[model samples]
Target: MSPARGGWVILLSVVLAMLLSVVQLPQGTPDWLAWLRPNWLLLVVFYWVMALPHRLGLITAWLIGLFADVLHGEALGVNAFGLAGITYVTWSLYERLRMYTRAQQALLVLVLATLLELVLLAAQLVTLGLSFEWMGLVQTLVTAVMTALFWPPVFLVLRWLRRHLKVV
Candidate 1:
């Protein structure tokens, strides 16, 4: 249960998510399975930040965010700043967050996910001069919903790994 091993798990998950983000699934004229890009990286980082705050702190979050930026071809440091901020906020609330039930945890995740999206949108708007729209909010909301829906499975996986495989 060392932090190093936990970092590896998180790093692998992020990389996998990045690969998944780009894989095109064809169903019609447009690609299928394109909508599942529901902030998988954010979810993974949030999981570790909440579950293993002592191990994966803001620094790790920032680094992974940068990596995500490179992989996604997003503006440089956009994900880095947003993720670092979200991780810091989550880490600040870790003690209280740890006390919540799964349902409550999902709610918190929803809020945090929205925050992450907002931060990304804002950063892009500022740094890249991108125009903001209500759809961005909707997309973020969808991502939040997806993150909430996906939390239980992720939680179960990490819990099992923590118990069986030794991840800090």
Candidate 2:
């Protein structure tokens, strides 16, 4: 039998992720708090790729990252390259990742998100001659913390959507 499909749901999730990537904070928000903002697009892409590897993989991540690069007004392909790495790592380990407990998975997310930040930072340094800031590390830590905190709910919801839509 053929695997089920949920193309529209996947598209909708990706669009929402892109929108979240471009969302602005309130004017009075502190710089530290702003830095705590999670990488929503990365999280969404990770979730979908983990849950549906056969359906979503490197190309989807690269395209989503490209759109995000445009939305964030960053160097084109920065996010694409970073997300492609995430997809590769995730694709390689999807089976083990699925078998992991939530806490273990969150730890993995932390590592992956940190790697993504490092890749982007490295790219920026190469092309823009940007100096490293301690804040960048802090931001990476916060992104991981947020990803860990958010993963359970997001996973549950996506799993529900997949089951409801009969996506294989």
Candidate 3:
């Protein structure tokens, strides 16, 4: 499919992921419970970057990352930098990544998701002087694991959408 024809599907998926990224649990939920919220935007961008590097990848991710910054009302460039890092790594290694099975990809997703969280944590520390005493570290790891575990279902669904919608 032409980029013009198929691009809306890609955009729609990204928008949905963005919306999911900000979903808040009910009030009085434990703070640690927040760690269970998968990085929906990260997973979606990873899928698109892996599946169609030539069409929508790094730049798109960076833009979405900027949006993430606004969405979270954080300092500019934090999410942008984190997302750019993910996109660049994925773009560079996508060929090899495509050869791996779903389980293997989930393992790598764990790593990438961890790295993204670390970047965010580092930015927060540098910009706002937070997370110096490992306060967020555990939650970061938990979130990464959650994101990784979510990979299989996210991958299957997006792959199906790509095939059925013929997103190129």
Candidate 4:
């Protein structure tokens, strides 16, 4: 698994994940929980940070975050800062996270996913002076749950792709 090829694999995966994250319609609210949305981009970024930290570092996360901000029409640099900060935390602890079992990693992903959403919320508050909504927090929880639940399959498929394609 050469580093160069690994970079390409990560780039392609991130692109696909970003597309999925941004192109979805809002599902109607459920009686129990309605703010739930899939955090596809966060999951992919988390995976790459843990699996190939050297290739997709904080800069990449920040750039993607900015792109997400543009695509979603949020405040500029709101998601960029959040994603970069989380990426920094993930990268700093990448080695330790890489050693965790799949279940543990999934738990960690949930925590990080929640944190990412919160960071974006805070950024929005500070930048635009937007009123904080409890629904925003609830949405974060939903995102965390969805990210955690879907992580195993995404991780397994990515791991297999990396191993089979000779990507690091």
Identify the leading candidate in terms of TM-score.
Answer: 3
TM values, all candidates: 0.84, 0.89, 0.91, 0.84
The digit string of per-residue lDDT tens for model 1 on 88-151 reads 9889988898899989988887887888778777876787887878877777777778878888
Identify the superior model by lDDT, candidate 2 or candidate 4.
2
RMSD of every prediction: 2.6, 1.8, 1.8, 2.8
Q: Model 4: per-residue lDDT, tens digit, 1-168?
A: 543665778878878887877664557646454345568788888888888787787888999999989987778887788778878888998899888988998898888888877877787777888788888777778888888888999999888988988776
Per-residue lDDT for 29 in model 1?
45
Per-residue lDDT value at 42 in model 2: 74
Give, for candidate 1, the lowest lDDT window spanning 10 residues.
29-38
Residue runs of model 4 more than 4 Å from their true location after superposition:
1-3, 25-34, 126-129
Comparison by lDDT, 1 against 2, better one: 2
Tens-digit lDDT string for candidate 3 (1-168): 454459888889989998888888889989877768999988998999999898776677889999999998878998988888999999998999999999999999999999999888778788887547665888788889999999999999999999999887
Query: Between 1 and 3, whose lDDT is larger?
Result: 3
Which structure is stronger by TM-score: 2 or 3?
3
A best-first ranking of the candidates according to their lDDT comes to 3, 2, 4, 1
Which of candidates 1 and 3 reaches a greater TM-score? Answer: 3
lDDT of 2: 0.82
Estimate every model's Cα lDDT from 0 to 1: 0.78, 0.82, 0.89, 0.81
